[model samples]
Target: MSLPETMQLSLGPVLFYWTRERYADFYREAADWPVEIVYLGESVCSRRRDMKLDDWLGLGRELTQSGKQVVLSSQTLIESEADLRDLRRLCDNGEFRIEANDQSALQRLSAARLPFVAGAALNLYNPATIAVMARAGMQRWHAPVEMSRNDLARLLADCRSEGLDQPCEVFAHGHLPLAWSSRCFTARHHRKPKDRCQFVCRQHPEGLALRSQESKEVFTLNGIQTLSGACQDLRHEVSDMAGMGVGVARLSPRAEGMAGVVAAFDAARRGELSAPDPLALVEAEICDGYWHARPGMDNSRATTAP
Candidate 1:
């Protein structure tokens, strides 16, 4: 019942705006989890100042001491010079590896000759771009969320032919980060502007859920990040991913029941259990169409079946 020897579990950065204590506590608990890699830092919005860079670094140090490979993640969108400065500090920290969520971070890390992880937000679609990233010192790559299994297989086959050996990771669990916007949707929901919005995002803990006029869950808004209403569950596809030469499976951190989630994936990878039904862990609908090259929201159970 052994899984692929190369398959490792990774904990992605916390996408939610959590209290500093809760955030620290989460990592403290994660320090002993079965996961091998831990990605830290605030990657969504620059306004989430509840946890600063030093706090993340301090936590990263603790995780590293606990024997986990920690990687500092950069913001997905860089809107201000201050954000740029913060990104620079993360890159120059010269301790843990960096997960470049934005191209600016990629350029900074490449220029410094530091090996980095090209995050899913980078939109690395083809082997050509992947090769370019490899040349730029991307030691690992997280395939974009929308990429299908067949597409990734073809790309990886091409990369193999070209002798590109950079390892790749996939977002295997949690809510899919669909898109980013400059406008603060959270503030707008609270009748506030982007500049003076009094940090209303914290009130939702897991981001505010948005529903259609018919009361169908559509999207979730967290500051400027728009996420899928249904959390993505690719545990069923772990074997497929392993067959494609994926080296790591990223489990994005959630607010509650993360321990059980991690255990489920761990056991699944160890071939002790099947992937738990994603709907059991989430209140919203579940989707896996993107993995099948269909509509992003269409899982076999959805009403919009083909």
Candidate 2:
């Protein structure tokens, strides 16, 4: 099948804690990457204040000047009044669009009548839910991480029947975010309370890997967010997603080798099958079972060299 000419690549927001300088350098280099869109801001935990709202807006402006579309993302878990205030500030930033990661963000943005990009954490499942979000001024949305390709195709078909045209973006690559908790898993791992974590998450930029009794990697602990142990690679399915009317492919940020990930996806979109395999550039095992309607950890398809 022919790839959709309009399908674009997006860099998802940074999900792990990093030093302020490291965050700045990442975006500075990402400006030259192949992605057309970039989501900025700390989306995982509220205690991660390395970069504040003004800092994020400043970075967004820089990226915008570099010819990339930037969207300010809201925190996924709103546990405090401080978090609410941050969300309000993000919604009123007046510069870049917002990516609503939770219900609070959606409410604030909708109340202000501003259009937003719905984050995957919103858990939008069917066309009926998407129609409601569309009416609430959602201009784009990320498919839930567990949504199968067949489910997405069916959802898109239903949206078309209802005349809902908001663009759908898939979490095409990176560690799949599985859950968020009020307690800080990283802090607990360090034998500290959530309030006294002392910012230990910074030590593990990619996240603390969790393993099962059999010593198999299972999940990753990043502050309050739980992520998949194996990186989810969907480069092989980009053409199928394009054919299903997906408008954007989102790659979650990793601590290293992001340039290769962007290049590999770009090559896939352009049908350059000879590009270097993105799987080779990452440290974790790769999986695509969720995309194929199987267990999330299963890699149903055999790996093929690109």
Candidate 3:
């Protein structure tokens, strides 16, 4: 779909472990896709060192040269001085926008007078919090994964009343990022300690799915990050999001079929296709309950563009 330039289709950072070659190959392929903005980095576990600061910056430059707005994402959980050092380098890179996934990143960026994206992990639950970030030089903010459409509308309205007009980005697709821990669930599943786990996460490019004792899919484990067992497909809410004055719609990078995902969202935005049920594109069940302000795991109801 030929969407207006104001409405951007963005690609979020890869959240799982991948080989360096695979990571580079994915972005090379993405350069030709319909996405307008591309976020680059390892946002999950700091130990996934397949890509480093220089590598991320190099790729970010390449993507920027390819005519895509590139943003560097910080680690969601900072566990050590090394992590903070890496986060400092990302914020100081000065070549691309930085997506501050945690308060540490935000503090660095704010202190440096550098404009950044407030990533979903920053706990931006209300307009007042957003106003503080705006004052701290947040150019755009990604709404928390659990925030509903009405929640977003209300926040936007409240911010507008305060004359705070920072752009809002939504996590429109991908497994919902639920929580982060000091421990690695993936390693625990394999009976290995996080520091000595031998990089088992490389095997589960899409993440290791965890099921309940009842044999129901429950959650996905990617190193220290826990995600929704169901993939979030808000393709159906494109029109509603656009109407709500959303500036960017982010699609998280998966190991496979990302081209099709980008094409699907591009087409859906152009009115060429109904946002296909997100479930149709992946092996996991689809969920949009959080968009309706319901339980994050509830998929019993959804609302699409009229």
Candidate 4:
């Protein structure tokens, strides 16, 4: 399949807890990456205080000046009053747009009459649901990580039939955020309570790998967010997504080798068929089954770049 000429790459918000310096350094490097859009903010546990809204806004301004479209992302699980306050502040940020990761964010953005990005955690499954969100000021929507390509194509077709024109963004790369909980799994792993847990999530920048009883990799524990054990690489599906009217391909931030991942996807979109597979540069086991409408961890397709 030919590469899509207009398909653009995006940098999703950092789901893991990182030090303030590492966070700044990541965006500093990302500012020059080929991604056209960059989502900024702490969308995970609210205990992650390394980079607050001000710091994210500052980075957004820098990236915006560096020629990248910046979008502030809201937390996925709004558990407390503090989380709600942070969400309000993110919604009130006058400079850049926001990605509504939860219904609280959707309500805040909708009440303010602001156009926002509907995040994958929103669980929008059908054209009717997407149309409802579009009416509520959703300019773009992210397909849930578990959504199959066939389902996505059907949803897009239904949207077209209903005259809905909002752009669709797919989580094309990185560890798929599977679920979120009020309890901090990382803290529990350390035998510590959720409240007094000493910010240990920052220690595992790529998240703590969870293995099965037989010692096979199962999932990753990143504080409150549970992510896929294997990384998801959809470089081969860039053409397929483009054919289905997908406007953006999001690559979640990793602790290392992101520049190469960005370059690989960028090359694929530009018809650089000879580019190497991005999975080769990533540290985790790679899978693309969800894109092929199979189990999320299944990787039956070839891993080579298309």
Candidate 5:
């Protein structure tokens, strides 16, 4: 499909733990929000048992009733037969689109002829891969947390030239999901392995905060994934994003206070909002340098995100 100029808002899948009731209630309330798309599923360690496939599908159906486009997310870094099976099932489900997080999921999705969402976990950098995927039935392509505006502009231009029609979504907010591993770090840190993780990642909600040698709080450990300590804040970059032709800005879920964030982005997109520090208190530290190919931890005052 051709990309539109209208600003789109989406809530990326929750990467933390909340009770099943809380999870359901969150989506229930999201029906009243201005979000256009909602991605649901357990993308992290399968050990996260707050909800199951049937429960997720039920919520997806309810969210669809609310007039929101729902996509089921596949696990990144699939290791076992079970993971592959689940990915195939999600990709095969004609009821909703699949968000393929890894190449394995991408392969299955491609073979299934499903127009899917290319999850950020896939390092889809250039136009050729994007075109290939679009031809293979990719409907939307999500920019990895660290992609920059200039690079994105080139990619979009390339898409237009290649006649590849796909919406480009960016990680406009939330903690930068930096890396994922085959072994569970949060569980390992607590003296455990993948098979015996005992699902410790869930207990931490927002993942376990990891500090530096200087005792600086630098990163967070969730299951086998490592993330930036500071949540990515694109509140100030809404104009830049729109100007650069971003179709949608994905706001990752937080522990609380997300509606205000949604409202801020919407108002900004529509020229109804103003702020000096839009995401003032949300980020542990601001870092847009990664998006600029600079130091991943460096914060820029000229165009910092926070």
Candidate 6:
């Protein structure tokens, strides 16, 4: 089967610790956004309980009412009984689709015989892995960050040959979620233990900044997640992704100026995008090397400086 010319847009789960009011306002406003799918839930540290399951379900209902496919995402690192309980509840809801972010959640979800969306955190690198998960009932799979255009093309081909049905979604914008560890960087930075973080990450909604060994602005530190400092702008590759069988472009939420971010990506996908200083207003610098199969940090735009 051939892919469509226009790729769909999807807003990924909000990964920061925003206040209840801020969180409500953000999704409430997003209820009208033209994205095809919206994944909502606490995918980061669970201690940051700014919103509860009921609140998330309420927003999911609202978004679903607005005709958007809503997926409640499971936690990335489920280490607590409470987290596991929440995961069970989310998957058991039977009302909204769920995104499995970790192995534990995936195992439980599989055991329950419930189908779930494959969150990007899943290691779906090749055709064999993709086929394995597809057979296990992954209706849709999120493309990993470091996976490339060619790799995805082969996976798509294999999906077709193996009859592993699923829609492909790519991480288009937002800081690249590099890694998640059991240790909290925020607490480590302050010389505090993980058990007593004092919620330091809540202060920097986007995340704390980290410089490179060369003293260059490089990475951002979230509780236990290290992310690329650059806001990945793959709008330019919207058409390319679609050609390679990508159905949706997944955009991660940022603290400030999400409306503009959505609009810019929407416009770019339609090939009607034109803006002055588009790069300057970005909350972080831009990166697209992984999409182009180049080094993650080096900018293709910078190399061809003509």
Query: Which whole-number lDDT from 0 to 100 does residue 108 have in model 3?
Result: 95
Candidate 6 lDDT over residue span 227-289, tens digit each: 887778887677678777788899999889898888877776776666423353365777878
- Between prediction 3 and prediction 6, the one with superior lDDT is 3
TM-score of each: 0.95, 0.96, 0.95, 0.95, 0.92, 0.93
Q: Rate the local accuracy (lDDT) of all candidates.
A: 0.88, 0.90, 0.87, 0.89, 0.80, 0.82
Instruction: Give candidate 4 regions above 4 Å deviation.
Output: 275-279, 302-306
Better of 2 and 5 by TM-score: 2
Candidate 1 lDDT over residue span 7-93, tens digit each:
999999998889988897899899989999999999999988878788888999999999999999999999999999999999999
Q: Between which residue pairs do clashes occur in model 4?
A: none
TM-score of structure candidate 5? 0.92
| Clashing pairs for predicted structure model 3, backbone only | 1-270
lDDT of 2 by residue, 1-306 (tens): 347778999999999999999999999999999899999999998888878888998999999999999999899989989999888988998989999999999999999999999999899998889989999999999999999999999999989999998999999989999999998989999999999999999999999999999887899899999999888999878888888899999999999999998998898898885644444447887888899998888765445453
Q: For every candidate structure, what is the RMSD over all alpha carbons to the true structure, in angstroms? A: 2.0, 1.8, 2.3, 2.0, 3.0, 2.5
Candidate 4 weakest ten by summed lDDT: 272-281
**Candidate 3 error regions (>4 Å):** 1-4, 275-279, 300-306
lDDT: which candidate is best?
2
What would the TM-score be for candidate 4 when compared with the true structure? Answer: 0.95
The better-scoring model by TM-score among 3 and 5 is 3
Worst 10 residues of 3 by lDDT: 297-306
Tens digit per residue, CA lDDT, model 5, 86-178: 777777777888899989888987886777899888878988888788888889889877888778888887887888768889998777898
Candidate number of the best TM-score: 2
The residue pairs in collision within model 2 are: none
Model 1 bad stretches (over 4 Å) = 275-279, 301-306
Worst lDDT 10-window in candidate 6: 274-283
